[model samples]
Target: MIGLNLRLHWIYVPYLSSGRSIRLQINTVIMNPNLDDVDRKILRELQTDGRASFRDISSRIGVSTPTVSARVQAMTDMGLIKGYSTLLDADMLGQVSVILTINAKPSHLEDVYERLMEDEMVRQIFILSDSRLLCMLSFYNQVKYKMFIETISKIPEILSMDASMILKAPKENQRAALTDEAGLLIRCYYCGHMIHDEGVKIKMDGKYHYLCCPVCSKLYKEKYEKLRKSA
Candidate 1:
């Protein structure tokens, strides 16, 4: 059971896809920095166990110990290494692990954020472009999943929402995807803020919000079009 503490807030950006050249997209991955084969290997290894030592990572990746240390240090310096966390067993805590894709009234965002954070079940919460909020819930079972939907609906700001169960996880651990190329940036819909991106980092409505590099661009698409229409 984790919730928001109001520590995160910023100007929002939306990530969208276009037929433009790939170079532009690469520029958008600034937050993630850059990587090479060695860096990629280091990242892959770190995902399995974040607590792995630098010397161990160096030997495994066939790089000098100092080289591995420098890469790891660079990643942290660049803010790519968000942090290391332990995966928990939600079931043992009287909760079930579930995924939720939310759609809410745009204006009542703070209200929505507050409501979701009130629950101890939401270990993670992310806001998406199309006026949606995504949450991983810690509840008893599917029944609690449904109850979550019902409870959120009580707020008028919550127009509607749907959720699903995570059956299998290719990568059960959490870490930013590293690559030589860049990833899309996203916005936290709650406060209209930018979220760092790394390889399609955000999702909503069973669809990947991979098209845009920033969440605000997606959210403002209609506004941009409306202006063009009036012009």
Candidate 2:
């Protein structure tokens, strides 16, 4: 945990449900902190029940309470484990989920991104190839949704945008596979995205990591080597 410096993405999104809208702030930190079998077990248990006490985790993982506490504290200190929180039902709250795709000028990518981040209704943002953006948005009613569209239209370099409602989501935040499937599948070590045909596979810290692209692969190798040399 000593050399860990993770990327924490903060999102402030609107939860629209039952014609009511509320703000929901979410932070997802992706970190690669040399985790072991015990650490993965602890995380699995925590994901199953975040309210589970250290004593309960210790019993499940077959470790002492103090050991579990120390490991959890280390991960927390490293910013890998932010905090324990409960999930709320957005549909019950009158919130509808939609995915917004936008095409904009390459020069305006950064500016348009910053502008989009200003709206609390924008939950997650992704900049695809060629200045295309994919965003997750939530809105309460037609008035607000139209207002959002009008506001986005005012952006000078934005070309077009398409919004699609998410009717159902079987999995939202489930990251870890139920079994040891990492080896069978190609995944990006940096962003944890599933990699297709194009990727860079490299060995780091005595383990193999496949990055989704050259950029992430280069960054991961440089950071890993720098940390290894310093250590």
Candidate 3:
């Protein structure tokens, strides 16, 4: 069973269609900085109310407004904070939810994955251990659901698919309890490599940037300065 304390977040890509985008979630742990007291406090506040202003969070946490703002921005740049979203009552909206377990041949997995990404009803997708995919799909009614099934059935890459409807969600969108041990996944801004140690850190444009080495730091700084100068 998944623990309630584990944070569920999505990393969004550039592919957008029909006012919806494909989101990929990372399930494995990555090495980075652990959360501090102030960081935890700010995340907790925002998790409770995403729309809370930085001033309100500062007052509640007994920190200055500027500090709250800076921390939030830094976290956002670091990808620790993915993005904000509003919760909606799917039941009231007459939306049907289903979980799809999909299996594709090794040679055609990417083809099948791309086809699914074009579907607006496909909300979330997870790559499983055995090279299968677990997808969450939403639809307005049975008619649309049947249509989607028929459409995907024509795809040759998808070997098999199993679907299970979600009848009810007893606890949905549970907030992650930010603890001191919680770590942020850091990556090199220049080389796009994961930083496993105390990597180089530099502040530019009022935001902190991480690099895996001194060489990367130098290169990233030069590139950033060039971009800024051109701008």
Q: What is the C-alpha local distance difference test score of each model?
A: 0.61, 0.71, 0.78
C-alpha lDDT of residue 215 in model 2: 58
Put down candidate 2 lDDT per residue, 14-123, tens digits, no spaces. 34455555443322223343566777777788889999999999998899999888888766643457688788777777877889999999988989999999999897
**Rank ordering of all candidates by lDDT, starting from the highest:** 3, 2, 1
Number of colliding residue pairs in model 2: 6
- lDDT per residue for candidate 1 within 131-229, as digits (tens), equals 889888767777877776777778888877777877655555443545556442444433345554322222343422322234343444445557768
Q: Positional deviation of 179 in candidate 3, in angstroms?
A: 3.5
Q: What would you estimate as the lDDT of candidate 2? A: 0.71
* TM-score winner between candidates 1 and 3: 3
The alpha-carbon deviation from the true structure for residue 143 of candidate 1, after best TM-score superposition, in angstroms, is 7.6
- Ten contiguous residues minimizing lDDT sum, candidate 2: 1-10
* Per-residue lDDT over 51-85 for candidate 3, one digit per residue giving the tens place of the 0 to 100 score: 99999999999999998998888678667888999
